[model samples]
Target: MSEIQNKSVALVTQIEGALADVSPSDRAQSFLERSLDLYFALGGPPEAAAKLVTQARSRAQLRVESAVANVVIELAAASHLSDIDMIQAAYNRLDVELKAERSKK
Candidate 1:
């Protein structure tokens, strides 16, 4: 990797480690913001920093979405409901969890 890419990866790893104890809902945005801040503070240029931030944000979002999807799948499976009911219950649970997470902010 190039210097900026290396730095960006390192910063993202550091941010993830620092936020490891944090709740999932708080992690995505915090990871992106911290990566950007730390990159800039490390004397990265504006253009490079913006690129890094975009990449970081994309990664964080993907992780969060993946986790949510996994939970929905697990919940649906564990409920032993019919196909349609499983989908509905999974979505309802997701909605409630999302609202609860939002309220925490």
Candidate 2:
């Protein structure tokens, strides 16, 4: 990975590790909210930290979507299904399932 990508991944991983130590009982705050709090606590500039987090989140989201698309393509090829409409429907179904799983605690 490039330096920026490596740094972003490291920062996100550090934030996630710290978040894991937070009390699970406190479920009121969202992850970004908590992550921002941690960033400020660690002496990072709020504006810069927010921008970094936003960029990292977007990259992570794209990676997930790409992975989903690859899986859909692989499955279609394995099943010998080459119809465009059917592949699109499969992708849509997988996207919905991914969203549903993400919504769960």
- Our model 2 lands, by Cα RMSD against the true structure, at 18.2
Q: Distance from true position, residue 102, model 2, in Å?
A: 31
Off by over 4 Å in 2: 1-29, 62-105
| Clashing pairs for predicted structure model 1, backbone only | none
The residue-by-residue lDDT of candidate 2 on 3-101, one tens digit each, is: 544544444444454445556445336644754664565566866976795786686455645855764575456445434464455456555655655
TM-score on alpha carbons, each prediction: 0.28, 0.28
Model 2 local distance difference test score:
0.54
Tens-place lDDT digits, model 1, residues 2-100:
554454444545434453566766665865575466456546698776676578567645565686676557545545533346545545655565566
